[model samples]
Target: MADFKSIKVTKGIKTLEIDNPTGYHLIGMGAQGAVFKLSEDRCVKIYTSPLQAKMEREALKAGQHLSFFPRLYEYGDNYNVIDYFNAPTLKEYLRNCTYIPESIAMKLLDILGEMKKAKFTMVDAPLRHIFVLENEELKLIDHVNAFKRIHPVPLKLLRDLNMMLLKESFLSRVKKLEPKTYEMWQAYFNENKMDYRNIPVDPGGDGEGVKVDSAISQTLIGAGHQGAVYRVSENKCVKIYPKTQHCEQEKDVLLSHQDLSFIPKVYETGNNYVVMEYLSGPDLNTFLKKQSALPPVVSKLLLKILTSQKQAGFKQIDAPLRHVFVTNNGFKMVDHVYSYSRIQKRPLELFQNLHERGFLDAFLEQVKVLDPATHAEWTKKPIPLTDEEAQLEIINIEGKTDSKRKKGKDQGKDRDKGRDHKKGHNRDRDRSQKREHGGKRDNGDKKNRNRSKEHGRENDRKKRSDRIK
Candidate 1:
């Protein structure tokens, strides 16, 4: 890399800051650090933390025997010099390829065998870390967690391969070449309800509420693995439970959080359904997918939600990111499937999961920017902020968010009016058809009466003429 002396790095929870003075092109990034392409043969792996850098250094030492892994030339406290070997990762490779060749499948299986022979664990061979070169070679990298790990098979690679862009096509080839391996994969993909066919689950009907489908007036907005959630009215939605007593458990979780606005208020409940406030907004998962970084207001809202749950006598706050939503009112947590019933608390479970996934460090970097002093102190012992305190911190970001929601509401209102107008137009059309049909019936009756009179007149004339003769 040219002008490398000027590059500086700062790490965040999910991302990193690279002050690259040399203008090196960025090839990839993760929780560990960013990689910048220096030239065709070399690149640098910048570490987010000293520990990760040390781990990678050690990984390089252990993996020296493996020709496919990146060769470590030199290392600093925060970065490492290694072979660039610019090639698409297997994940990228599979995504771009129109079809998977039988040869590639054979190569992958052979690689697994080689990994075992080399005493390398399956953890070292993630499809994303493995690269495919033009010379029919697979370059496997990233052995931070691969050392001495034990697994009968490459489970992560199997799952990653399962989530391939062209899943069916990839599987078809695997089934043809490796039948037993494909069978193992099929069973794993099915979870508890194993299906050999690997057909997609139909995204319709409440499993238990199918019998009561006729009574449902609203459209089914979401159907999950467990149950179907429907938007019934303007402010209310219903979750129809499975055949089991699942609704009881979910309802209990909701009833426990009646006091919190962050949770949807339970309006009514039935034996197999839960009628709750319909929160209209994108879920956290969807929002995060489109974002470059987590907004400060969102971070604050997350803290408050966790704190409130803890204060409300709930032991678990390990809510999935998908269950949380960003609404006009603010953030609200939904799907309390993992709360109240369990006594064991998962207070920092969300953060811990993020950290393990390499997002926590990048997110914390943002927190540091928002409040450096607090960030410095929280590093030693993390603490949640009060509602008032969080509100004060993100006041500016909150205002911007509110403005965006106002714009969205205006658009929503226009859409609703258009739908109403369409309904009214259909009703008017029906009324016009009824009036036209009624006029046709009346005209037919009048014509029939005139014909009867003419027939009577003709009969009378015939009788008079016959009498005269």
Candidate 2:
């Protein structure tokens, strides 16, 4: 047996002459090691476990049959290297856009079809493992669950059911990949009397949890002590926890509410995450920066979201500003991963503290109007959003939306929008140049020629009059 801890690789481990060791820009992380960008186009995945590294190599070799996966450049005992594409992972692409487009999703189905044809299964098939390449081609990565068919094993029905559940949540994306792949795989498994023992099971949901990709999205927005927020779809945010317990707890609380518009919908949950809805526009903090001092109407909308959470009997809102996403309709409380604690006073204290700081007089008034049950605990709220109170809470954002912003560290400055602005400028310049080339250039030339002619005529007349005299 090979030592699973370490192995000395011989052929494929030559160091590229990079300015630095290279492969440090981390695109994603997993239980084993971090995946880093080798350059603008390639990536190197280093694993702590020698076993995992070898498995990665083996899978890559096997996956050569499938084109949607990365072209594995080289693999050894310590590291696996592959060519990277300019495409965003499904997790990141989902953030700014609503629903996976059929074109891309169908491509994913093609990749899945190849895997099934190889008699392989993705143990974890969440959004993270799926990448949307530049040409709307869906690529599947991280094949830790790849396996061959094994005959005459028990518990076949249960395994099939679990795989079915996974297929269901991602029905949209999966539909795009290859339609009969799953059905064909099922038939093959049944025909061979195969058991899915080698298939990795998702710990999220029930026995047959949907397979999820484990890659973290590049577009993660709000991060805090409890969890981080990712855009799952154009108008939805997936709040994932560092640990599984938090995800489970938040799912329970979110499922209790039925008003989908006021709250982002919870799609799925696992030990580490609750896949929820994402919203566009800005968080309360960003909105405040642009609008500068919330108008009464906006404040009311903000208050309405907070009050809804209050009505839902939530306590300990870790980051309230992050939870409140401002859209044209109103503010919606999008994150619930940290708010549903049984201890009610914690969130109430945060509300009172914000009120003292003048973060929300309108918010306080709305909460105060919360008939009996909700307001009963908030009596004698001493400090409101006063200067001192604001100063105090400034160090720590008190509510779920705000707390999401200031989980434990002093908030970092927002990323400069320079890159986005530059891209827009370049696009505009291209359009302007195209239009100019396609249209007439004679108007300015004609005006200039008329002026020159008038000046020349006046000069000629002066010369003629002088000669006649």
Query: Candidate 1: misplaced stretches above 4 Å?
Result: 1-6, 96-99, 148-151, 165-469
Q: List candidate 2 stretches off by more than 4 Å.
A: 1-23, 90-106, 123-128, 132-138, 148-300, 303-319, 325-329, 332-469
Best by lDDT: 1
All-Cα superposition RMSD per candidate? 29.5, 20.0
lDDT of each: 0.55, 0.45
lDDT of 1: 0.55
lDDT of 2 at 232: 37
lDDT of 1 by residue, 10-127 (tens): 7642235666656666666655676776767877777778777887788787777776767888888877878876566676667667777777777777666666676665433556
Clashes of each: 9, 46
Question: What would the TM-score be for candidate 1 when compared with the true structure?
Answer: 0.41
RMSD of 1: 29.5
